[model samples]
Target: MAGSRFVGHIKMWFFFVPLLSVALMPAAPDPSLFDIPDAEAASVASSLGEVRTADAIDTTNRTFKHYFVATGLVQASMASSGETQIEDGGVANFASRWVHNFWRLVYRMVYRITVMKYWLLGMLVFGIAMFTDGTVRRKVRAAAAGYVSPLSFHLAGHGILLVFGVTFTVLIAPLPLIAPYWLAIAACLGALLWKAASTYQ
Candidate 1:
């Protein structure tokens, strides 16, 4: 009786093992799960195009920017949702300061060139010459009537002072962009001349 009962238990275990294995297996993914209607996709695409067009137009006007939604329905939904709460845990102050400093730096480069224009321009020219090969710099130096090597102390000293002069001149100079870009080309030539003269001196 004991041997017969042990054989019956083994038979039950064999039946349940395959059943448990099948139950634990993952289901196969169906391809049709994320299918969206064609009409809905087309509407969304049109709305995106409208938003892009408005943004492109706004960029040309530098004074102020206006945020525009493509569809009235979208705007209505956003208005109903109200403003989102951004949880920065007091990091907002740092973020604001960072943005302010960034814009200040950019403004100094663009509209407020009077302060550091020469220094910036001179550094730019010096950096270019320094990073370039000696032979190439020698050729340019010869053209400029100077013997400053690409990595020489003289080059750096002149370049350092050159920025001030260039920035001063750029601030005082009136460089208007002419039709067909002739004046712009002239201004570029003027810059090259200035660089050469600074190095030559």
Candidate 2:
């Protein structure tokens, strides 16, 4: 009876040992080669355009010209706005002092509430806009090679600012009690410009 019991115990151990070993073994990782999609690879290659065996210098000249023209337009617009404030006198000094002090107070209050919180918020908003505009430009460029320009992004940003500025100005201008609200449109435009310049960079 003892020998029969020992043999049964040995048989059970042998059966479970194989099962435990199998369970303990780690699974083989899937191969990475299968991860690449054919369509994605084709899309990437298409975006780069064809590389020429020759210098291909003249081929890209048009792109350079377009970039220069777009940049020049932005520069001209900024210059025309007198944003540099070349002529500064009593009125300009007074306005500058008040605006500067007001913004400083606003910044201090915002910072006290949360360190660099508004800066981060502005950055996040700008990033989203940049991404959206870039995607649009990419699609436009894909459809027509010369359609993409830096001005397109600038115009899009300005258009967004203009819409909000006009809306606020119109809404408040109608209220006789708040005549000063009309002036807020200019303030909003200035704030938008400052935000656009700083945030985009």
Candidate 3:
């Protein structure tokens, strides 16, 4: 009986020792498993940087557009204001006064011409002979025996006046007066040309 009990105890020790050792041992890792890939991490970082760069570029463009729009609005407002001021004060008063004086002069000249037609005509002829291109007048006079043709005199005076007036007013006159003044000069030119043509021969 004693030998059988000792044998049973030894068998129990053998089984329990092996089970305990197995429970305490550390587990071995799988060879197929690995840490995070370096290529994948670099790609993710580069993608985040690209997003930031795109956002910065978009912000810069938006800022420039806003600045340009504001500047345009300011310039437009200033132009409108200047236009209104000119219409209300400077150009309006000057144009009104000029038109009034011009018409008054025209009326006076018309009355004088109607009252003293023959005398004024004689004086105009004398004046042209005295003041015009002396060479042309002398040639015409010598050729026609003291008869002065009015064509050269009128053409020179009217042509010079027309060119000077058009050039001066177009280049130097204000915007408001340019159209009316240019039209007046053109009409004078037309009348002068008509007179020159009639007396050409």
Candidate 4:
């Protein structure tokens, strides 16, 4: 149920981005791609019993509405399988593609830590401070004051993990996640860090 809700939220988020984009754009289009012959349109309308008039009125040329395009954009979620069809080969490699992607992301996370100087330095300093300085740790805990009890801490920790997981998924997403998404990620990580700083040792 939680998984369904998560996916629903992701899809809802996907649905809004394209709508927001269109609202900022110029106007409606008359694209040839969505166009069909007058005869075909009339036949379709008649078959669907949607034609209200006695005669099938013909417009200059019909095209699909922007709503179709906007909703179609929701299909581009990161969790979706990129492969439309499997390749023909002697040995068709039957493997879970998302599992491979999951490990690849994990490797990338670790690899970035090793290669990026700022990340490495920050991790080292943060780790040292959390482990060594009791006052600093307490101050950090005070920053994330709401999740004080163990139950709240655990719940917040899980929530942070879910957000981080979604962030990782967005790495390979087709949608333009943009700056706001990154800002949210930064805030989430900062909260997690504050929570982590509350250590007894």
Candidate No. with top lDDT: 4
Instruction: Give the runs in model 3 whose Cα sits over 4 Å from its true position.
Output: 1-148, 151-165
TM-score of 4: 0.31
lDDT of 4 by residue, 7-46 (tens): 6555544554434433322122322212233543444344
Output the worst ten-in-a-row residue range by lDDT, candidate 4: 56-65
Query: Local error of candidate 2 at 127, Å?
Result: 18
Give the better candidate number (3 or 4) by lDDT: 4
lDDT (CA) per prediction: 0.38, 0.38, 0.40, 0.41
Cα lDDT of candidate 4 equals 0.41
Please give the lDDT score for candidate 1.
0.38
Error of 3 at 35 (Å): 76
Compare candidates 1 and 2 on TM-score and give the better one.
1
Candidate 3: lDDT of 36?
20
Model 3 residue pairs with clashes: none
- After TM-score superposition, the amount by which residue 120's alpha carbon in candidate 2 deviates from its true location, in angstroms, is 26
- Quote the lDDT for 47 in model 1: 37
Provide the RMSD of all predictions against the true structure, rounded to 1 decimal.
28.6, 34.7, 51.4, 20.6
**Could you estimate the TM-score for every candidate?**
0.21, 0.19, 0.22, 0.31
lDDT score for residue 96 of model 3: 40
Query: Is candidate 2 or 3 superior in TM-score?
Result: 3
lDDT of 2: 0.38
